[model samples]
Target: MQHLLLVAATILTSDPVPEDEDVVAGWPGFVIFIGLILAVAVLGYFLTKQLKRTEANRKAGVFGPVDDEEPRDPEEPRS
Candidate 1:
């Protein structure tokens, strides 16, 4: 257990430091992230609207009345 703990500690503490240029490039990097968030929000809004319409239609039975058709073999006698 001591050996495993030492290996885990070393791995946890070791991290690469970012360079000066990487640290300074903030807004440009964030622009793409912000754009992705907006796109996802727009898509979610449209999907919600479509689902609401479908649910309303389902409640109203807009597709038409349900048929009472039954499946039967060709050789079976009809009532």
Candidate 2:
């Protein structure tokens, strides 16, 4: 219909201006962003430390026998 076409054309041509032109992420947003970055950094540091300790423990055979040794049978008595 002609009325529908006219309405569509008007809608397409119209550019609605915003009430506040200077919209921005303020100080609170900046602070939260900084906090997230710091949290990730701290978590990464702790994770690295724990991973190093675990690697050291593994090399020292804390978990069990070394990889080169054959696994012992459960039914066999220890010497």
Candidate 3:
């Protein structure tokens, strides 16, 4: 049993592909290409949505300035 297992393991681990063989050919390649394009498009859509939301928040003063009080002269002492 041990010898059988050893032989089987050696055969399974050996390199299966020959130099002449082409990888990712035909229909499989087309499917992968389309999947990659769709992934990028979906990512871009969400990114654009987030950026627009942030811009809207900024314009609406969701992020307040450092000084809420009116701008004072530099020489004026802080109360």
Candidate 4:
């Protein structure tokens, strides 16, 4: 138990040494980050445009006639 305690104290007192100081996210990483941002922006813009067009088409009754009837309860029998 005395030898184990001594070994633990030595390990706890040692300083950590870094292997490399030069490793970093350089120009390639920055370029890829910018690319991902642009891709998400473009996709969001297109999605909004498509949704607006679909809403306009639905209002124009392109798919079918719009129902003007009141919503019926599921418990009620169909007339």
Candidate 5:
């Protein structure tokens, strides 16, 4: 068993370890394409929802700024 283990270790140590650059170069385009698809999807979703809300608000009449009571005197220093 010890001899077998020694032979395996020697084989493994003699082989060159794989490098990151080779792995990264193989998949760079796939990563960038996925990122672009994700970004377009998110932006489209938000813009669609915003447009829908604006249309609904326009129909509801209570769309603009609020007009409640009077403004307090700013002269009083806040604690």
Candidate 6:
């Protein structure tokens, strides 16, 4: 957990950058930090939406045989 925070802190650089060069430096840094966070959140939302849709499609019918053949009891004969 500590390592993960450290990496995030590193990615959100706090080194002073000139206002004129602020575009990429992210000036106060929180600017880009917030943007990056939002971007990830939006992507995550869309990803989960897709995942749910796929899971719904994969859901099995509640009242039908699972496969083409009828499910047989353990005691049923094959002969």
Quick one: best TM-score, which candidate?
4
* Native-to-model Cα distance after best TM-score fit, residue 75 in candidate 3, in Å: 19
Q: Which residue runs does candidate 6 get wrong by more than 4 Å?
A: 1-28, 60-79
lDDT of 3 by residue, 11-78 (tens): 98895875655654789889999999999999999999999999888777888644445688889876
The most accurate candidate by lDDT is 2
lDDT of all predictions: 0.82, 0.87, 0.84, 0.86, 0.80, 0.74
Rank ordering of all candidates by TM-score, starting from the highest? 4, 2, 3, 1, 5, 6
What lDDT does candidate 2 reach at residue 60? Answer: 90
- Candidate 5 lDDT for residue 79: 43
**Per-residue error (Å), model 6, residue 15:** 16
Error of 4 at 14 (Å): 24
Give the per-residue lDDT digits (tens) of candidate 5, residues 8-29. Answer: 9999999997887755544678
TM-score of candidate 4 versus the correct structure, residues matched by position: 0.59
The TM-score of candidate 6 is 0.41
What stretches of model 1 exceed 4 Å from their correct place? 1-25, 64-79
Give the TM-score of each candidate. 0.48, 0.57, 0.52, 0.59, 0.45, 0.41
Candidate 4 stretches greater than 4 Å from native: 1-20, 67-79
Candidate 6 residues 1-79, lDDT tens each?
A: 9999998898778765668655564466888789899999999999999988866655554434344366677797754
lDDT of 1 by residue, 1-79 (tens): 9999999999888977878776764788799889999999999999999999987886677966433465567797655
Over 4 Å off, model 5: 1-25, 63-79
| Arranged by lDDT, best first | 2, 4, 3, 1, 5, 6
Give, for candidate 2, the lowest lDDT window spanning 10 residues: 15-24
lDDT of 3 at 23: 57
